[model samples]
Target: MLMRTGVALAGFYFVAQGDWTRLLACFLAARAAVTRLTRPDEEKPHRLAEEVGREP
Candidate 1:
């Protein structure tokens, strides 16, 4: 999430500088970062078994 925000800010800086190519690249990078951050974590198939074996 923080990384995404940083990328967005960088993109804004590029826009302010009139660097269109860099701005586009930054936008794409930010979009991908946000997408990855928002994605759900994959479930571990053996989680229950592992938990059951962890008795101290």
Candidate 2:
């Protein structure tokens, strides 16, 4: 949620400052980074439950 909020804030800031090229580049970079970072770890709801010491 925090990561998403930061991305949203960055987008609005870029738009307000009229930096179209920078906005596009930043968005692409973020997309690539998120894809790479999350690719190794597939989410499973059951795993999350266990992590928090709960049963699924």
Candidate 3:
């Protein structure tokens, strides 16, 4: 999430500087980041805590 945020912020810089090529590159990179960000986490840390909490 942080990485994607940083990449998006960088894109704004590229746009401000009129770097079209890099801006396009950032767009592609952001797409890839979004793919990962949207994917379900295979190693969710909360699962363990939830399982423990459920043990009344």
Q: What's every prediction's RMSD, in angstroms?
A: 8.6, 10.0, 9.5
Candidate 3 off by > 4 Å: 1-16, 41-56
Q: Write the per-residue lDDT of candidate 2 for residues 1-56, one digit (tens) a residue.
A: 99999989777566657677777777688788887767744453467677899866
The stretch of ten residues in a row with the least summed lDDT in candidate 2 is: 39-48
lDDT of model number 1: 0.71
Model 2, residue pairs in steric clash: none
The list of candidate 2 runs beyond 4 A from truth reads 1-7, 11-16, 41-56
TM-score, cand. 1: 0.46
Top candidate (TM-score)? 1
Question: What tens-digit string does per-residue lDDT give for candidate 3 at 1-56?
Answer: 99998976876676747677776776788788878778786644466678788622
Question: Candidate 3, overall lDDT?
Answer: 0.72
Per model, state how many residue pairs clash: 0, 0, 0
Ranking by lDDT: 2, 3, 1
Q: Which ten residues in a row have the lowest lDDT in candidate 1?
A: 40-49
lDDT tens digits, residues 1-56, model 1?
A: 99997976865776758777776776787789888778765633357667788623
* Model 1: per-residue Cα lDDT at residue 56: 32
